[model samples]
Target: MSEWLSVCVAISLLLSLVTATAAYMLYSGLIAHINVLTGSPPIKKITFAYKFRQGLYRNCGQLFRESHNIGPKLPCIGVFYDDPNEVPGPQCRYVVGSILSEGEKDADKELQKRYEASGFQVFSFPEVTHVVTCWFPNRTFFSSLLGVRRVYPRLARYIKERRLCAHPFLEIYREGRIHFMGPLARQGDFYVPEVRRAERRLSEEDELHSDSDVSGVDSNSEYSSGSGVLLSDSRETSPADSWVHSPPQQDGGDRGSRRRSSGEVSFKELDWEQSGGQQQQQQQEGTEVEPRPEPSQKSPEAPTQEWWGVSGEE
Candidate 1:
């Protein structure tokens, strides 16, 4: 009985240990997930500018007004990687950025110098269109992961809103110079005014050519109508030629008689032609033209038929 009780207690202890281990693992995973989602900034010694900028964004409307005209409010993302308590002040890093646009190399270098002078380690990417608030840090896998989650969403949103076609987002660390991590959301060349102008010119030229072709067609049609010779010789004959070729008439009466004779001859010819055509049509159809019945006439009465007799009563 004692051996059985000892065995049961040992089994219970083993079960409790397993449960505790599982719970600890689950709790750690939950915390890690929360950290990833929230993108909590790492502990780092940041400058007053970094803190002020963050506070400004948090209370943007209440603390700052549009009257300040600091340009449009851009999407900003924080980047930090070292624990200030562990790293020395000069070695710690903190970074943030809001504006992103094409930057000149010389200008970027100048900006970097200016920021470094203010005790900030700025990452200036000429290829990348971004304004970052950066500082030094102790590199770690977890810090890098946190930075990606924190910055990627903001960078993607900025690219989409601005319709940026091509931009670089990458970071490298070598020779004590720290390059921060960034994301390129799209792939293509940036827009240029020259390309747009060239397209517009080509379209305009095409339109002009089309207009010219249409105008040529219209002009050719007009020219043909105006300069074309009469196809029929009969159309070319004038009224004067007919009058001159005709025999001379002594007076208007002779002219009128000639015209009447010609007209009568034409009328007789037309009547003969019409009759022949009607006979041919009837033969073709195998039908005879039935004669119309004449109206009946009353017979003449004899002179003696009108004899009348006086009434006997009269």
Candidate 2:
């Protein structure tokens, strides 16, 4: 009985040890698996997010650069009208207000030039109403197009307010055209550089001219005759004799109109009429004059005797 009891006790002890070992192994495996999953739960997700964001930033930056390069040159040229599926018929192909035709005497050539410069090929599909072809290599083309629209805020707003989308180039045509409406590409060197330099030089010259005029006035005031005298006093103090020699003040408009010589007088008849009246007056005075008189004879004798108040009698 003692041996059997001991055997049973030993068997129970072995079973307990095996159960504990199994439980420990299962718990350890579960902990390791949980730790493996939870330790860096978002590592893959974060990496993917970073890559996506980086790609987006790169694409956006590229688009901005391209937009700036082409904006000024394109000048908001586009096809007008809606209805994505509608194909534009040749007869329906009325060109709208595109910068392409602006300042270009030749319509077809100007249109062609704009496309070529943009690195885009012109594609006219008979099926599509208007497949406004833009030179786009892959999706970059779309991005650039979008950027082009965003480049000129004022122009874009004007277009939208007027629904220029209905007729892309028409408004511009009616408005007498737009030059490089936005940014310019490298081809700008053909005209922009020289034009800008000329404008800057003209502005500088204008400033210099203005400064020179101001300085000239100041110098004249400092050294010109009549300096340090009041304007009123200068005129009042001039000698009366000096008037014959002094030039009339320029401020009084033309002096020639103020005075005319007798030769320039048109009324010779009026002068003759006045002379006749004077002659009549002189004749009337002669008739009124009495004889100097015998009084002259009497008074003359008295004066001769009195030559010396001492008296000729004395």
Candidate 3:
């Protein structure tokens, strides 16, 4: 009788422990969800350093790692630009990096410069309004996974229910919490210039590809007329004229096949950009660009800025 009683007590304790643990997790999650629903993320005017990347969001872990390794405990942020369900993983765009300052508590100028030297782009967003925000605890890596899984669905539902035009979702991790924010206004402001240009160029390329497909035009036959030139309506347009070079398609050639994105800067490209940037700064140093006359310039307009395999036509 005593043995049976002891076994029963042990089983009851085990059940109680399991029940308490489960309830604690559930309660924590429930509280976070409720707070997120009612909370407003504080996205004040701030300076940030970020590296933009075009790839799967899952792959953005590397960016986070790099940022954290560089500036541990600094507020880190991830900006996602597409829904995986709607956009292909390969086409998704994102930027991840650390915040340099918020109002006061400014970071060291040298620190900011260091980050920039390491291929991170720096920008400041003025105080913006109509921002939708929420936060989740990030005590562990698992918290990030949990926060993403729980928060996004609620955010989507909330936006859908209210018919809000929030865009370019942001996840800001600071002081063991992740604040999710999406701005209803100035949504375009968050997209860096490179990303904007990339999107525009990509759309143009997609249109061109679709037209070729619809017209059943042989890509090979047209380019054969000239080296890296496309003959359209008796006009020869060299690929070199564009911001990005679209080399003539060679038989089974992988060289010049893949394009480099803003985030994926190569060592050679970095050296070239350093040289180019120095030259550009020198050209405009002590010169007034804001007061330039429209339609008539004393000197020829600075060569249209060209970059990464894309036309600089503006």
For every candidate, C-alpha RMSD to the true structure in Å: 45.3, 43.0, 18.3
- The residue pairs that clash in candidate 1, if any, are 92-136, 93-136, 95-133, 96-133, 100-129
**Considering lDDT, where higher is better, how would the candidates rank from best to worst?**
3, 1, 2
lDDT per residue for candidate 1 within 1-314, as digits (tens), equals: 99999999999999999998766544433123221111211212112111112111122222122211222232232322222222232332223432222233132444434434544333322242332212222133233333333333333343335433211122232222223332222111111222223324533543454445633232111101001100011111120111101121121111001112334356657766777788788979998975432221211110000000000010
Native RMSD of candidate 2 (Å): 43.0
Model 3 local distance difference test score: 0.53
Global lDDT of model 2: 0.24
Task: Name the candidate that leads on TM-score.
Answer: 3
Tens digits of lDDT, candidate 2, 199-251:
34533543454445633232111111110101010011121111001121211
Count of backbone clashes for each model? 5, 14, 6
lDDT of 1 at 173: 26
- Comparing 1 and 3 by TM-score, which wins? 3
Deviation from native of the Cα of residue 239 in model 3, angstroms: 39
